[model samples]
Target: MPASADADLTTEFERLSLPLADPFTIARGTTETAENVLVQVSDGSHEGIGAAAPSTYYGETPATVEAVLPDLLEVVEEVGDPHVRQRIDRELRERVGANPAARAAVDTALADLAAKRLDVPLYRQWGLDPAAAPTSSFSIGLAEPDETRRWAERAVDEGYSILKVKLGAGRTAERLAAVREGAPEATVRVDANAAWTPAEAVAKTETLSGHGVEFVEQPVPADDIAGLRRVRDQGAVPVAADESVERATDVPSIADAVDIVVAKLQKCGSLRETRRVAEIAQARGCEAMIGCMVASNATIAASAHLAPLFDYADLDGSLLLDADPFEGVPMSDGEIDLAAVDRSGTGAVEVDE
Candidate 1:
């Protein structure tokens, strides 16, 4: 691929749905419908796909994400030269402003296109070693104890060895106990989505810790950095920063408070920015987890490329979708089969017309 081809990149967007059996809820609340933002980049014959989902936590809706697409595309079109990819990557962070999920659609699509042009797998492009990829934790949304147990049992039956449960609606203890009983052999964890106060988080963590729960995610508010540190100090269970640590700059302040940093592609703007955040977390001796925003196969593929670079991964958003557009990355037995992506870029298959 010649550097000149970089200047010819173009983008497009589409919307898709999720396949979850029931509504999924976290500390940010619940959603019955799953809407995703798909980004497609084309340079003559070869094309690449990327995906993202609007995050209500960032005040983003499908319409808002779509509205930002044109401007993001314009930025990608104007930048030229070999560094065009890197330049477009930087411009996205600057002009795109906030809304990582929106920017992620653009950045990931462009990266996919570039990778296809170079004929290389996205992970190889990022200098990641596939053998080092981390195991991803499959998620279990909130529900009645019996229902939650059923879901956990299904996940384990599906061959998933690690599970992350959504807590904080009510009956926290009972809900967790049900998951344990359901998936007795699997490693279990929970995320409260910042639903508790520091004291409440500590109390909840202490209670859940007795059940062999691995760790808790964002128990308190994101802005409560000090509160998070306190929770971390008080519990035997480690506290991971999800919403609190979005940008790379936030790393230093909460370095001592979090044992793990969850980097959501949508929350961090683009894959380039997401990688930077991961680098920062690693420097601080904190483990990195690459998460998604309830996206589709396109976006999930982009995230999967970064999975090998982190300690934890939760890229099951595509699997939850009712109809994912692209193919390539396969989610089975609690792991994403990335063998197809060995070639380059997103390694995503074309969306059916």
Candidate 2:
């Protein structure tokens, strides 16, 4: 109940309501702002920082994460070394219950602090080869057919070779065709965000095949496993599960139904758990796609540490923000340049005030 005299550390957090470049719409709803909380763990000189951005779909809000993090900070301050991440993480997961976003913030901050103490980047600390990091896909949110084409072209102009287009809006086929027309050479993945019925998903997947779409994500509702299986069986394009696989246990239940399993740090809580979920997906013969909620660079940088473990990377959460107060991983030409981030921890640093 009391920290030892040898354990002297400081922990702090702040709320952030970051604005998006545009109103981001999905099958669920639209968001013009990202509600997040930033966490920092320090032992005198060395410090590590991370952020938690809650997603409404995950049943978390900024208020909930903020309320839970204070108690979490108290528990983590007693930790002598943040490198024993599993022990702290397991305790937090147990204490925090279903609050994955809060757990992610603390887990990443401790990890960052530990890596910084060792003077090595998080990738190296985790024994992950930096070169193995995958290229990330730029997201094009839902819009009219012409606007969709414009967004696709904008992403291409910004040196993004892969585009993840948001579907489920009207004119799905035409919009996808427009996306292809805009960035004909770029890899295209579509996310319906669980907007369609099994039959509609099958038909849309068939139509999207003509547009050179690579995969369709969460085509059916999260609860509709049979529907998902029907889409996977009857559809031509590969299917990825987003809303369905929040936890590792959710993976096996839908592994046989989908071709890909999407994992997010916010939903998985800890980086360790997110990695485990990805591993589970790969072991089940499903492609592992590391995804992100609309968050700041701190969150994205934390997720980038595990980028090598995934088949696909969607670490563009910070890119959607209108302004970022921190610098984490660097993205150049749609790829995470790990060399630039080879300094310490997650390589996330606050902008000089």
lDDT of 2 by residue, 234-282 (tens): 9989899989988999999999999999999999999988998999999
Model 1 per-residue lDDT tens digits across residues 124-212: 77787776777778888878899999999998988889999998756888998899889988888899988889988888887788878
Tell me each candidate's TM-score: 0.93, 0.96
The per-candidate count of clashes, in order, stands at 13, 0
The whole-model lDDT of each prediction reads 0.78, 0.87
lDDT of 1: 0.78
Question: What RMSD, rounded to one decimal, does every model reach?
Answer: 3.2, 2.3
Model 1 backbone overlap count: 13
**Candidate 1 Cα outliers beyond 4 Å, as residue runs:** 1-7, 80-83, 340-343, 351-353
- Worst 10-residue lDDT window for candidate 2 reads 1-10
